[model samples]
Target chain A: MIAVIDYGAGNLRSAVRALQHVGAHLQVTDRAADLEAADAIVLPGVGATRDTMNALQRLELASALPRLIHAGVPFLGICVGMQVLAEQSEEWGLHPCLGIIPGTVRRFPSHVGKIPQIGWNQVMSCAATPLLAGIPDGSAFYFVHSFYVDTLDPLLVAGRTDYGIQFPALLHSGNVAATQFHPEKSGRWGLHLLRNWIRSVT
Target chain B: MLTRRIIPCLDVKAGRVVKGVTFADHIDAGDPVALAALYDREGADELVFYDITASSDERAIMVEVVEQTAAQVFIPLTVGGGIRTVADMYRMLRAGADKVSINTAAVLHPLLINEGAQRFGSQCVVVSIDARRVPRSHPTDPLRWTVFTHTGGAGRATELDAVAWAKQAVELGAGELVINSIDADGTRDGYDLPLLQAIASAVGVPVIASGGAGTLDHILAAVTVGQADAALAASIFHFGTYTIAQAKHFLAEHDVPVRLV
Candidate 1:
C-alpha cells in the first residue's frame, strides 16, 4: 500500500481523494510503522515549509522520511512536501529540513507578479522521467505556493517552470521524486502524472 | 508562462445550482456535482462554488456538495459564501476545497483574513469583494466604487472604497482577490472593466474578474483590457451558452495564453 503522510497540513483531503481516484491502494497515516511497511510513500502538504517541518517533527516522521528515502523506498512529495525535501528553507528564517536533496527553498521575488503564485503555470520538462512520461512539456499545472526549490545539483532537476525566474518544477533523484505543483489539482495532466508515478513505483 | 484561467462559478442554494439576475430572481440550473464534473471535462481551469444558502441548517449540504464534487473533479476547487470564521474555512478545506473565499466575513472582521492565512497559508485564503460603482458627483471626477455585502435582498452597501479595500485585503493576507461588480452582475452585457482594472492594478496578487461575462469577447477583455488574471462567470457556462473549451479557444485566438484541452 502507498502511505500518504498526514501531519495536519491543509487540504490533505484533496490529495487523498485524488490518489484514490487514480487507482492507488493508499493509507493516510501519521505513523512511522505505516511508512515502513508501505511499498511506496506519498507526502502531500500545503502551507509554509516551517509549519510542515514542525508537524513532521511533532509526529516523529521527519527523520523516518529521509531514512526511508535513503533505503530506496519510492517517494513523492507535493508542494510543501517537496519543499521539505531540501536541506533548508529561507521562509520565515533559516531552518533545516530533511536534507534528502542538497538545496534550499527560496521565496519568489516581489516582481514575479504575485507572492503566492496561484494559478495554472506551464511546467517544461528538463529530462525524460517516468513521472512526466505521457504529459506534454509546457503543460499548465496548478501551482499555489510562494517558495521554489533551488537545488544544488542540476542533474536532479527534472522540470523547470518560469514565473519571473525559471524554478525547479519537478525533482527526481534515485528513489525519490517530487513536484512543486499540485498534480492532484492540475486536472487531466495532473491525474496522468500521478498514474505515471504510481506505475513506475508499483 | 502562466496561462489566464477560465473559471465557472456555481451559485448553489440548498444543494442545487442556481443563477440570478443582479442577485435576484433565482433560476434553478442543475446538480452542482454533475455540473462540476462537466466543467472539469470541458477544460475549465478552475471551479468556484458559492453557497448562497441563508439558513445555517443547510450549510452542511454545501460541505457535502464540495465533498462529492472533489471526488470527481481533479482541478482546483474554491468554496465561498457563508464562511464567517476560521472554523468555517476549515470545514470546506477539510472537505476537499483547495481555497476558501470569504467576502462579508473578511470585511466585517478583517482579522479573519489574517487568521485564516496564518493557519492555512495565504494561498488558501481568497478575499472576494462585491462592489457596485458609486455615481460620480461631477464629470471631472474619476470613477469611484464602494464595497457591498450580503447579497440576500437588495444588498447592503459598505461605503468602503473598492480599490483601497483591494490593497488592504492583500496586506491583511489575501492571496487572491475576486472583484465582483454588482452593477454589471447577471446583466450579461459585460464586466465592469474600469472597476476590474482599478482593483487589478491596485493589488499584486491574481485578481479574478467576476459578476459580468456575456460573450466570448467579454471574457477575453477581462484579461486583455481589464488586466484580470482570471475571468469567472455563472449563467453563461450554466446555461450552455458557451463551453469552457470555446472560451479558451477564443482567448487563445485573441493572443491571450490559455490552457486548451
Candidate 2:
C-alpha cells in the first residue's frame, strides 16, 4: 500500500481523490507506522515554509521524514513538500528543512509579476526520473507558489517550470523525488504522473 | 514571465447562469456546466462566477452550480457575492471553487478578511470591491466610492478610506484583490484607470480590473494604465461579443505580455 503523509496540510481530499482515481493505495495520516509500512511515501504539502515546518514538528513527522528518505524508500513530495527537501528556506525568516537534497529555498523577487504565480504553468524536464515517467515534455501543471528552491546539484532536477524565471519543478535522486506542481490538481496528465510514482515503488 | 490573464465571468442564479442588466433584468445565458466547459475549451485562463442571490435557497443553488462547473472545467474558478462567513467560504471551496471572494461582507466586517485568511490561508481569500463615485462626496472625498452590496441596492455611510482598507486587507492576509468600479460597471466606457492605478500603488499583490470594458481598447487601457494583472468582463463574454481569444490577441498587439488563448 502507498502511504500519503498528511501533516495538517492543504487539499488532502484532492490528493486522496487523485490516488483513488489512479488505483493507488493511499492511506492519509501523520502516524509513523503508516510511513514505515507503505511501499512508497508521498508527502503532500502547501503554504509558507515556517508554518509547514512547524506543523510537521508539532505532528512529530519531521524526524520520521528524513529517516524514511534515508532508508531508500521511494518518496514523492508535492509543491511546498518539494521545497522542504532543500537545506533551508528564507520565507518568514530563515528556517531549516528536510535537507534530503542539497539546496535552499528563496522567495521570487517582486519584479516577477506579483509574488505568487497562482495558475497552471508549463514545465520543462531537466533530468530523467520515474516520478515524471510518461509525462509530456512541456506539460502544463497547476502551480500556486511565490517561493522556489535553488539546488546545488543541477543534475537531480527532473523538471523545470518557468514563471518570470526558470525554477526547478521536480527533483529526483536515487529513491527520493519531488514535484513543484500539484500533479493531483493537474487533471488526467497529473493523475498519470502520480500513478507512475506509486507504481515505481510497489 | 507572467502573462496577463483574460477572465470570463458568469453570474449564476438558481443553478443556471442568467445575465442581468446592471443588477436586475436577469436573462438565461445558458446552463452553467455547459457554459463553463465552453469557456475552458475557448482558452480562458480563469473563470469567475458571481452569485447574485440574497437568500439561503439561492445560495444552495449557487453551490450546485459551482459543483457542476468544477466537475466540467479544469481551470481556476473564483466565486463572489453572498460569501459572508468562514462556513460560506468552505462550502464554495469544498464544492470545488479554486478561490472564494468576499465583497460587501468584508466591507461590513473588515475582520472577516483577517479571520478567513487565518483559517483558510490567504491564497484562497479574495476581496472583491464595488466602489461607486458619488460627486457629493467630492474629488477630495476619500469616501466618494460607496461600497455597494445586495446588487448595488444597499450601502452604509462610511468615512473610511478604500485605499487604506485595501492595504489593510492585504496586511490582514488577502493574497489577491479585485477592484470593481461601480461607476464604470456595465458602462462599457472602459475601466476606471485612475482607481486601478491607485489600488496598485497601495498594495503589493495582484489586482484584477473589473467593471468597465466596452471595446478591445478598454482592456488595453486597463492593462497599460490601470496596471492590472487580469481583466474580468461579464456581458461582453456572456453575450459572445468578444471572445477571450480576441482579447489575448488585442493585448499582444498592444505590446502587452498576455498569455495567448
lDDT by residue (B25-110, candidate 2, tens digit) is 24234677777766666667778888877789999988888877665566678898889899999998888787899987887788
- Give stretches of model 2 more than 4 Å off: A18-25, A110-113, A120-122, A128-141, A162-165, A184-202, B20-29, B134-146, B152-157, B253-255
Residue B9 accuracy (lDDT) in model 1: 91
Model 1, position A43: C-alpha lDDT score: 91
Worst 10 residues of 2 chain B by lDDT: B20-29
lDDT tens per residue, model 2, A82-135: 998889999889999988888899998877776788766777877777776777
Best by lDDT: 1
- Candidate 1 chain B TM? 0.95
lDDT of each residue in B73-192, candidate 1, tens digit only: 999999998999999999998898989999988889999999998888788899999999888889989999999988756789996999999999999999999999999998999999
Docking verdict class for candidate 2: acceptable
* Model 1: DockQ score: 0.85
lDDT of 2 at A92: 88
Candidate 1 local Cα displacement, residue B38, angstroms: 0.5
lDDT of 2 at A197: 77
